[model samples]
Target: MNMPNYFELFDLPVQLPVDVSLLTANYQQLQRQYHPDNFATANDNDKMVMVQKSAMINDGYHTLKNPIKAAEHLLSLKGFDAATEQNIIHDADFLMEQFVLREKLEDIESQDDFVILDDFHSEVFARQHDVYKQLLEFINKQDWEAALNQIFKIRYLTRLIEQIEKLQEKQYAL
Candidate 1:
């Protein structure tokens, strides 16, 4: 089966930061065009095709909506493999920084104060934003290696932020 290029499907440029408003509009258009309800009276084969098209549209919209996923898609379109298990981040400094952040998160988790958790959440988000900016710059320069490294860092920071948010929720419930 031939897979459609998501950028082509959305009439979008193959870039990191896609035009969100345009993407959303295009997505809604596609969704309406291929909605299963429209195919209710169609033959089985045509109905199946519409369902497949709708699934692809949903997948493409979600993939393009997320920055990391969009970056990976862009890299894939450029013939670079997205992060695989083999593509380990070798930056010792980044690894060390993540370790430090994890330690801080643990300390905050042990504390009863919501203020510290909020502060940690902010710090993690700032770090994630910094890495995201670097990823954008690297992608613009076509520096796939650096961009992949930044993707890894961003992934780590995202998980850390999620953990902090979970802890905050738990604190709020107390």
Candidate 2:
């Protein structure tokens, strides 16, 4: 198989904030084009080529569809090792803030305090605004490195929201 271009791999613009509908459409198109059945009458080599392309297409679909995943992929693409840096998490104040908020969340569980969830959501949303402002700066300066750094923090906040949702589900299921 040819080295896959991002456009051909995701079948979308090599652009940020990809259009969801178009991404899905392109994915379906590739599935039809590269289905193994299309190569059924071809030689074994051709069939293997089709199999490989299909796998790449599927992987690309996943990476481009989610913002957090896309940011991680983008950082890797730019040769930035976010995981290698301890500096991002080296903010002692921020670490203490997270610990305090987590304790508050745990305490509110017994109170069935929906207000605590709202407060957490509001706090994250507020942080998102700051992150977005930084994102704008990165975009203005064309600094993929800064954008990549802030994006990782955004992903961390997103994961917290997902955890809250899961906790809500488990609580309600009881």
Candidate 3:
């Protein structure tokens, strides 16, 4: 499929911090217009076209919907090689920290043992906040390279939080 311009894809401003109301309206309109059932009059090829367009619209909406995702998309468009999920561990220290957190989470022996997990959560949240700040600041300054690195950091922290939440939920289930 030919890649539509990001702005054209979502009917958005093609700029950072897009007008969200306009984007939302346009997305819904596109979705309704291209919904496969609505293309019943068209031939198979035409229907496929509509389906692809609808998928592009959905993809574009998601990219511009959240600030972190928007920032990452913008950076990627700028040619920054923001690490994908597979390459999230660019920093050894960050990986080691995740390792320790995972270990602590598995060894939760008692209610009191959960205190250390709480402390770890605080530390992780703080680190995640720091990464978020850096990402936003980089975007504000149009520093796509720095923003790419920050995006990876954000993904790492986000995954860690998911793992932590899983562990916490398990503890409560006991």
Question: Which digits, one per residue and each the tens of the lDDT, describe model 2 over residues 16-117?
Answer: 566778888989988999999999999999899899888988888887787555555555556655556543654467567667766766776766756676
Off by over 4 Å in 2: 1-5, 81-87, 90-93, 118-133, 136-140
Which TM-score value belongs to model 1? 0.93
Best by lDDT: 1
Q: Any residue pairs clashing in model 1, and if so which? A: none
The local distance difference test score of each candidate is: 0.87, 0.69, 0.73
Query: Per-residue lDDT for 63-96 in model 3, tens only?
Result: 7887677776676666664545345446788678
Number of the candidate with higher TM-score, 1 or 2: 1
Give the local distance difference test score of model 3.
0.73
Error of 3 at 51 (Å): 0.9
List clash counts for every candidate, in order.
0, 0, 0
* Rank by TM-score (best first): 1, 2, 3
Off by over 4 Å in 3: 14-20, 83-123
**Candidate 1 vs candidate 3, lDDT winner:** 1
Report the C-alpha lDDT of model 1 over 69-116, residue by residue, as the tens digit.
998888777766676535578999989998999998888777778998
